[model samples]
Target: MSQSLDRALTLLGSLGDGPVSLGQAAASIGVHKSTALRLLRTLEEHGFVHRLSDRRYRLGGRVLSLAQRALQGIDVRQVAAPYLAALHERFGCTVQLAVLEDDEVLYLDELTGRWSTGAGLPDRIGRRAPAAGTAIGRVLLAGLPQDGRAEEELPAELAAVRRRGWAAESSGHLETVTSVAAPVAGSDRRAVAACAVSAPADRVSPAELVRLVPELLCTAEAISLAYGGSPTPRWCENRCGARPVVRASRT
Candidate 1:
C-alpha cells in the first residue's frame, strides 16, 4: 500500500476507539503532527472525521450514516432465513423476506410451504411489486417517516397498519390468497425489511391467518433481534415482557 493511503486508513481506524489528540493520532500512525493534521483535514473535507471543540478528532456523522446504510443493505435473506423457514415449517404457508427499494417491495428470499406445489404464489425472490398495494409493502411503508402527515391526509389503511404494527392483504383475481406481514427493524427502529406468510385462502382461511398473527409477529421480532434491533415495543410490553425469545435451532 502507498504510505500516504496506509497512514490515512490507520488514522481513521484509530479514531474509532474514541476522539484522539493531534499528537495521539500522529503517534498511532507513526507520523508527524503536520502529517496527521493534513490527513485529518482531508478526511474532514470528505465528512469522514470532525474536529472537536477540544481540538481532538472523532469519527464524523458520515461514518454513522454509512454504517446504517450498510446494515440496511445486508442480505437480510440470510439473516432471516431460518426464522422464515421455521414459519413455513410450522404453518405450512409461504414465508418471504422483502425490502423497500425504489418505492417498491423487493423480495429477498422465500420458503415455499410444504402443503403447496408452489403454483399460485405471485411472489418470487428478487421480484418487485408496488409498495402500497401489498401486505409486506404496507408494513414496510408504515414504518417509514410519516413526514408530519395529518390524520385525515394519511390513508386509513396505512394509518391502521402503523397503529396495528402489521398489515394484511388478499388477492382474488386468479386464486384467493391471504397474506400477513410484519416489520423487521434495524437498530434505528426503522423497518428495513418485512417478513410475511402467504397462502391460499381456502387452505388457510382469513380467520386462521389472523390467528397466526402471534407466530408471524414472533418470527418478525426474532429476525429483528437477530438483525441487531430490539423487539417491537408493544409486543415486548404485552406478550414478550422482557422474556427471552428462543429461536429455531440451526443444525
Candidate 2:
C-alpha cells in the first residue's frame, strides 16, 4: 500500500480510543511529526478528522456520514432472504423481515409458507405496523436501550420480550393468527432488524412454537453472520437467559 494510504488507515484506527495530539498520533504510527501534520491536514480537508480547540484531532462528521452511507448500501432484506425462505420451508409458516422505521416496524420482505393462514400477515414489502403489537416489533423494541424510557414508559409486553430474548403473539393484531420473532443483530450485537414467522393459531400451538425457537434462533444467527455480525452460542445465554437444550446442528 502507498505510504499515505497506510498512514491514513493507521491514524483512523488509532482514533478509535478518542482524539489524539499530532505528536501522539505521529509517535503511535511511527511517522515523523511533519509527515503526520501534513496527513492530518489532508484528512481535515476531506472532513475525515476535526482539529479540536485543544489542538487534538478527533474523527469528523464525514466519518459518521460515510458509515451511514455504507450501512444504507447493505440491504438487510437481500442478506436475509435465503434464511427467511429456509425458515418458511421448515415451518411452512409465513416468514417476514422487518426493521424499525419511523418508530414502527416496516416489513421489508415476506414469503408465504405452504401452511400459512396468511391472516394479518404483512404480505407486502414496506407495510407498516404498530411496533407494540407485533412479534417483530416487540423484539426490535426490546433490543433498544432502556435508559431514556422509564419503566412505566415502556410497554409491559416489550419488557417481557426483552427478558425472554424473543417474542410471540397469539391472535394479536390479526385474529386467529400467531407470530414468533427473534432479532437479526448487526455487528454491534443489537437488532438492526428482526425475523418472524406467522401461522394460524390452530396450526401452531404455543408448545409447537416453543419447539421452533431453536430453528428461529439459528436462522436469525445465520442472517446476522451474513450481515458481518458476530454469532456465538452464547447469544441464547446472553439474550434469552436460557440455552437451547437441543441445539440446531448446522446443515
Candidate 3:
C-alpha cells in the first residue's frame, strides 16, 4: 500500500507540466492502463485530478485553489518587503505578510527584530496560521466571498473585518502576541492578501496598534494598486480619488 501510494504521488507530480491522458499516466507510473485508470479514479475522488470532457486529465480546482493562495501570498511578500522593512525599522518589532490558505493564514515573508537577528520566527514560507484567531486571518475572513458557495469557512468576525477594512487580535491566537492587520484587495474590492505586525501585546497598546491601521491600510492599498487591482469596494465604486474604479465584476 505504501509503495502504491508513493507511486501515485509521483505520477501526480508529473501533471505539473500539463494535462495527460490515461495511457500517459500509466506509462509514467510503469503500470498497465487499467491500473492507471484505477489510480486516477481514486485521485479524482479525492479532488486531486480532474477529467476533462475529452478524456484527458488535468490538475483540479482543489489544486488550483492551493496554487492561487500561494501566488497571492508570495506576491504580497514581493510587493510589501520594502514597506515592511521600513515599518520594522520604525517600530522595532517583527512584521509579517500573510494570506489565507484553506482556512489558515500562511506567512509569505517576515522581518524580524534588530536585537533578535532574524533567527527566532520559524521558516514559515509555506506554513499555515490558524485562520480563526490571527489578525491576518480575521481580515482575510472578512474579505472573502460571503456567498453560501464560498470555499472556506468565513466566520462572522471575518465578515465584520471586511466591512471595517481591518482586523486585530490581542493574545487571541498566540499568548503574549498582539497583531494588527489589514486586507489587500483585488479589483473587486475583495481581499487577495493581508499584512500584519506581531509584537508583545503589553508593549504595543491597542490604541497604538489602532493608530497604525491607516498606515497599514495605505501600504496594502499601494500594493494592491501596484498589482493593477482595486484597493477597496469604495474605490471600485468611485468614492475615493483615482481613475474611476474599473468594475472587477465578472460579466
Candidate 4:
C-alpha cells in the first residue's frame, strides 16, 4: 500500500476511539504534526473526518453512510447458499433466500428440489412477490421495525408470525403450493433476509411444513449467526412447542 494512504487509514481508525488532537493523530500514524494535518485536511475535504471546535477531529457522518451502503451491498445469498442446499436436501423441497424490496419479496437465491419443479412458486432468482401475500415476505415484514406501519393494523396471521418467528402459507396466490419461512436476522437482531422451503401441496402438506418449522428456525438461526446476527430469542427458540400444527392460511 502507499505509505501515505496507510498513514491516513491508520489515522482514521484511531479517530474511532474519539476526537483526537493533531499531535495525537500524528502519533497514531507515526508521523509529524504537519504530515498528520495534511492527511486530516484531505480527509475533512472528503467528508471522512470532522474537525471539532477544539481543533480535534473525529469520524464524520460520511463514514457512517459509506459503512451502511457497504453493508447493504453485501451478497447474503453466497453466505446462505450452503444452508439453503442442505435444507433442500433434507426436505426435498425448494429452498430460497429473500429480502423485502420495494414492498415485494425479491428472491436472491434458490435451491430447487425435484418435487418442486412444477410447484408453481416464484422459484426463479430475482422474482418478486407481493410482500404481504407470500410466506417469506410476511416473515420479512413481521421481522422489520414498525417504520411507519402499526402493529395493531397488521393481519392477524402476520402478527402471529412476528410473535412466533416464522410464517407458513398454503395455496396463497398459487393454490397448489405450500411454503414455510423464517427470518434470517442481522447483528441488530432484525431480519436481513428470509429463508423458506416451498413445495407442491401434494408433495408436502401444510402439516408437514409445520413440522419442518423447528429445523427451519434452526437453519435460519445458523445463517443469522454466520451473517453476524444475534441468536434467536428465547420466545422464538421455543419452535415446535410454541404453536400447535395448524393449517397455514393466506394472510
TM-score of each: 0.62, 0.59, 0.60, 0.61
Candidate 2: C-alpha RMSD to true structure equals 15.2
lDDT of candidate 3 over 75-192, digit per residue (tens): 5566667767767887776677787888888778777644343334444555577887788887887777767655335556655676678888877647666678887777687787
Residue pairs clashing, model 1: none
How does residue 191 of candidate 3 score in lDDT? 82
Q: Give one digit per residue, the lDDT tens place, for model 1 in 1-251.
A: 99999999889889877899999999999988999999999999999999999999999998878865664556666779778877788878889888999789888888887556755665376567788878999899888876777645667888889778899876733257788899987767889899988888778887888888888887788777676675564454365432235333222
Which parts of model 3 have CA positions greater than 4 angstroms off?
Answer: 1-73, 115-123, 148-155, 233-251
* Per-residue lDDT of model 4, residues 146-238, tens digit only: 776777777787789988899989976878888899998876788999999888888778998889888898788767766667755443346
Provide the RMSD of all predictions against the true structure, rounded to 1 decimal. Answer: 15.0, 15.2, 11.3, 15.6
Q: Give the backbone clash total of model 4.
A: 0
| TM-score quality measure for candidate 2 | 0.59
Query: Model 1: how far is 94 from its true place, Å?
Result: 0.5
Q: List the residue pairs that clash in candidate 3.
A: 142-158, 187-230
Question: Candidate 4 deviates by what RMSD?
Answer: 15.6
Candidate 4 TM-score versus the reference: 0.61
Error of 4 at 233 (Å): 5.0
- Model 1 segments more than 4 A misplaced: 1-73, 150-153, 172-175, 233-251
lDDT of each: 0.80, 0.78, 0.72, 0.80
Could you tell me which 10 consecutive residues in candidate 1 have the lowest summed lDDT? 242-251
Whole-model lDDT for model 2 versus the true structure?
A: 0.78
